[model samples]
Target chain A: MSQKRKLLVHIDALYRSALYLTKNENSADDLVQETYLKAFKSLQDDKEIRNVKAWLFRILMNTFINKYRKDKREPSLVDFDSVEAFHESIQEEVVAPSILDGESVLETLVDDDIKMALKALPDDFRMVILLSTVEGFSYKEISKIVNCPVGTVMSRIYRGRKMLKEKLAGYAQKYGFK
Target chain B: MNCNDVRKYLYAFLDDELDVEKNIEVLGHSNICCGCGRRMEKERLLQKRVRETVCEVKAPAYLEQMILKRTEEKPNFFISVVKKLMSERRLVSLAGIAAAIIMTVYFFAIPGNLKKDDFLYLAESKYHDYMMMPQLDLDIRSQDQEVIVEYLRKQTNSSIVLPEIRDNAKLIGAAMSEINGVKVSQVFYMHDGTPVSLMIICKPDSGSEDSKNVDFSGMKEILVDEKVVYYDDKGFCGHCKIMGWKEFGNEYVVVSKLNSDEMIKILKKA
Candidate 1:
């Protein structure tokens, strides 16, 4: 396959993440287009990219942060410091051992519910979550992609998943699903 | 492991991030503990739901077409060549020599027959080139004034002094070449997000044939700090302003999109 064709293979994954990050289809489309342009230029230089998916994602995330982030009306609700603060207080609010012992109502929570929950998250948390839970990038790969330490990536994933579950549980309860 | 310890590494265990020893420990504990096992299962189910929800989104068919079309467009030939050559340091001198020959032919082919407007055109063209691709042609990319001046002096074999323009402008870099045996240096700067070029040309000699080869008698002259300065507010090319002045027998020209007054206000510091 041509270099461009090989990159297009991951367009679905990139686009999906872009859609969730920007929360706008037009911005997602623009972001993906810009990413491909940069990737094509780099490929022309004959640089060897071992993992094209991760490389493409790094470009996408950097471009979003540098350019698109300027238009963001609100900053990431949670930063590394705040997330660390929450980590310190994790022991204070004891996570009951039996809190999630019963069957999950996640199946009853539809796609929209899941998306809204993801969107409601702070940009930082949602980024790590999408990269991990959806894209299946390892903690190491995600740390490289997001340009953060592995421990930070780990903390974000843990907190993000917990928050997502709470939002989904709220949605399920409103839907009268136990 | 106690419930708190198991929960601490629960997500890591579920994500397969834990090492073998830790993974086995979490697995062993959850196997015997009903609550922990159910919790792991619940977390797993939630992750699956999130994956299903997000992965359902596919790149629109048109997006692929749009990206392919855009990426397929060829980059500017000059820019690509310069960018490629910059990566290989050995070829840089050869590239510089070739570029000087090309520029010499461009500006000095009919030097004796040239008019004042031709100088303006040259200044405008060089300024546009520097602004469009600032990094590629620069021989020395430095913000330090002394560094750039020293490099230009060595390369052109001429004494070069850069005017300290204190208008929030930054000295980006400089490129030097011996055009038609006359040393020339182009210094680039950025002020208020706009690029400005300072072209410094070494005078051949007093009444030398090479000195009379290029004519500048037709340009509009003004006195700045008691020194005669040549300027063209009505630029030969587009709306860019071109100003030329003699300092210590060397020719200095300024070209930018700025108006004559704005250019003068900044050039007054020279």
Candidate 2:
């Protein structure tokens, strides 16, 4: 098979991320299509891509930031300085002990609830969390994908997970999940 | 590490992003400390849940087919035209002598079921084919703008002005071509070491057949220099962005790897 066809192995991963980012199936389809078009174009240049998955993800994120973000008017109002400060605050803040506890919250929580909570996150936080937690990209890999420092990626992932857990906990309360 | 320090490193540890020493320290602390150990499990579960939730979403069955279809290399139109022509016995014998005549008749006479808006797309395809050539075969090759303009005017028998690109791109040459049986002039330039083509196709006369008409009404319109210029930022065919506008009954299209904004700026400066 062609290299472009081989890249399809990551389609599920890319589409999931695209769906969450766009919050619409049609837009996600367009975004993924645009990503593959760009990838194919780059492949034509004969430049060797070392990590195809990470490279594809980078193109997806960049396209999202450039085209979709502007179209949706999703502003990056939270600057890196504030994000760093938020990380510092997270360090000092007391950890809310055991929201999940021994309870298998994942089993009780429906996919929509989890998806809704994740979708509600600010674009930056949602991006890092999706990259780090959901897609399992390493901190360094996410740093390159999102074009930010490793520290920034870590901060966003930390804060993003915290917010997601809190939201999930709220859902559990509403649904009477132990 | 204290409880606070261990909490800080918890995510990195779960993500396997920490160094070996830091990993051991976090692991050792979590092993002995009940609070840290429980927090570790909870966080791990959260990560797993998040991954599992999103991972359940597979791309739709049709998405793969759509992507493959869209990314598939478009067939070379010129080759298809030649194949169709070569399939006929009489055309094969006169192919060498009737190349230009075949082009004129194919574009103007046949109508070929092409939509009115296809005029621009056809021009874009011609530009794509030209760029694919191993070397440019320009009727007139010169860096002098007036010389190229004069050559096009003489070839097409129409006054034409080359749009002044604000960039350091130099006029390389000019070629005379026909689109939809309407005579057109193609001006070539080298911008930042990349070739750019500017095609000018004059609207056919009012008495001209309906098949020869070109349409720009459906394209996204922008006013540059107070003239309504339509642009297609989403490139046509290959990677070439196409921008066209009508002036004094002549349609101007600039096709290049340069983006829409830069192309617009060029039109504005013109």
Candidate 3:
């Protein structure tokens, strides 16, 4: 692939993965930017990489784990200050009252709740569930990305969803988020 | 099909992550079970909301443009630090792999050079140890040993006769032992000429022969095959297993001088 095309693919994949990981608009943009910088500097073996999307995802997940999980290890939501700020920032941009159905309204109700819920999950769980559910990666693909056993991937996705549902039950029921 | 398992995969289940058969099962279950169907519907709505909010309209336009510009720049110091860290990690992984190979060679590979006597002795000890306990079945402790013994006598035609063993073999008559927690009959046969002792142990607890250790003095080395001592329910192997485990309190241990196979043949005769 040409550098331009590769860049585009990298950009698109980063955008999607960053969004999934951060669950907030502004922070996702920051994450994607950070991922590319890191990916390029360590760009020794990406040519041999088949699934660029998953590879980028692994980077994003690792970045999240390194940057986010460590900070939140004490289960202190107070440490979630920056990401929460970005969420608030994104909310400001999307507050036009906008159309009801066409992603705008969709953006308003469950999007904020969903992102918070996803970000609220434990690091390992948040990544696995998003990659499998939102990104539609296979168990095998996820195993490669996360570099865990397939059984472990399945377990994380299962338990992660269970935990997410439980945490989101009230919000899901009240807002009709889905 | 259980509710717990269904709820576990409701999102992926709705997304068609499961194979077709399972998907169909989920759908069928959902249709019949209102709870599951609604949960599936709820998941569908959730995904739609997520994609709409996160992917399409979530991020700001200025952030996208800013990200595009910043994505290309790599600071030299950061790159060098990352490179150093990665190399160190690689070295650590290599060290781990080398250690694992050494331990594996020390343990499993060491067994290859063992002499036949060593193998026989190991096999005998292993077999005796395995047959003595109920490893697999948890509910075999209460099973009637007599029923299994009768089955064995009929199947092998008493080919595993114990009372009339040969001069070359020592008979360690019927005892109680468990295979997988199931109790069954048991018998022990050891040949004096060779060091091999064949133990007849029942599986799933053969109830009659629950795990009991026996020591019949002066037979030199006793080699038991732990793997084979297990019940092979197809024919009379179970009988061997049961008889091997079917001894009572400490009393009736009719020892003889016949070999192990001869003892099994005698049990078949009964």
Candidate 4:
């Protein structure tokens, strides 16, 4: 993809990542904006970043950590109860089920199913995986974004995927996967 | 490879994160484990399904407006930092200049111990919780009877240390209080229930003669819960008696309780 198109994709994806990190809309907006500012300045450097999307996500995630997580010393705000409820509610049928087949679910997919999956995963695991997978972040990039060892990034991804698959299984059994 | 290994590496392979060797091992295991193969396929489908379910959210229309406004104001943050650094540099230079001026003036300065004459002034301006003890009860612990006799001898000098107070008082018996530490002592006298305590200190600079309270006032007033003003002048370095009712190394409190009218009279005369 062209750099400009890629930057737009990155911007949208990082916004989702930030939203998942800080459940609050205002906070997510700020985190992603800060990510853009930093990414703009840092992109001026000569280092090679293999995946700009992942690189953007990592910067966004770290910015959230340094700005909000450390300052508040609390897990991201979560209401798993509501997440499960929303997922169950969506089982009646997606507002736009056909949107689920698109390469990037940017069209008209209900944000509820995604929100439900995100809420079920623990905050630390949820943020790391959402940021890495959706953004196609490499382990090294994720390690920097999450401010952890590459091993830790791998462990979290592994565990996060496991938890997500389990939740999806439950969703399938309880609500049936579309 | 067992079903467990198949399950573990299956996700890794789908993520395109497994090396070729691990992919070979996982593919081998999955071919033998029917359940693992089905599960691995479902997991891949689920990964795709999740990405498809999550729609990207864009910044609201106002986000652009906010960024543009903030950008114009952006240089202020860096400019403030530079301003702070420049001011700090100037302050350091000014302080260095002041120190040099002080050093030059020190040699010409009068014996600082003589400055004790201003004590009454600094003490009045300083924060003294005189309310902590409104009554004065003094006792003397002087081994030298001659010192008490001589200090009291001021009564015979016909010079009223506080002349206005002379109408209601003469130098009564010079009493002393328990000397606790460092030649710490209090000379006491009563002008009709108005008390006067002189906290005598044997400072490092001994040659200094008896100075009045007004001389103490000339020194800068340090606002503190209780200040420890270090006076280094005239070859003398002694803490200006802490001006407030504060617990210092010890309570070298010059205990005095003069009523409002009596205090006014004494201060007026002094």
Clashes of each: 0, 0, 79, 17
Ten-residue region with minimum lDDT total, candidate 4 chain A? A81-90
> Residue B160 of candidate 4: its Cα lDDT?
15
Name the lDDT value of residue B265 in candidate 4: 37
Give the Å error, residue B137, model 2: 58
Worst ten-residue run, lDDT, model 2 chain A? A77-86
Provide the global lDDT of candidate 2 against the true structure.
0.68
Better of 2 and 4 by lDDT: 2
lDDT of 3 by residue, B1-270 (tens): 866556645655765677888888777888888755765665666567655554553334465466556755565898888678668858788778879998898455542222221222223233323332213221122223344345444322332332333455544334443333322333444443222233333223222342333333322222233221311111111111111222234222222211233334433221
TM-score of chain B of 2: 0.42
Across A38-112, the per-residue lDDT of candidate 1 in tens digits comes to 998898899999999999999999888777766763355343223323234346436432233344455566789
Docking quality level of the chain pair in candidate 3 = incorrect
The residue-level lDDT of candidate 1 at B75 comes to 75
After superposition, which runs of candidate 4 have C-alpha atoms over 4 Å from their true positions?
A1-9, A41-52, A76-111, A169-178, B61-65, B84-270
Candidate 3 stretches greater than 4 Å from native:
A10-13, A19-30, A41-46, A68-110, A172-178, B1-5, B8-12, B31-34, B57-270
TM-score of 2: 0.55
Q: Every model's DockQ, to 2 decimals?
A: 0.20, 0.20, 0.08, 0.06
Alpha-carbon error at B95 in model 2, in Å? 34
Instruction: Compose the digit string of candidate 2's lDDT tens values, residues B210-250.
Output: 22222222223344566655444343222244454434322
Candidate 1 lDDT tens digits, B23-84: 98998999999877877787788788889989999999999998878866777999899778
Model 4 backbone overlap count: 17
Q: Order the numbered candidates by TM-score, best leading.
A: 1, 2, 4, 3
Between candidates 1 and 4, the lDDT winner: 1
Report, in order, each candidate's fnat.
0.47, 0.44, 0.13, 0.12
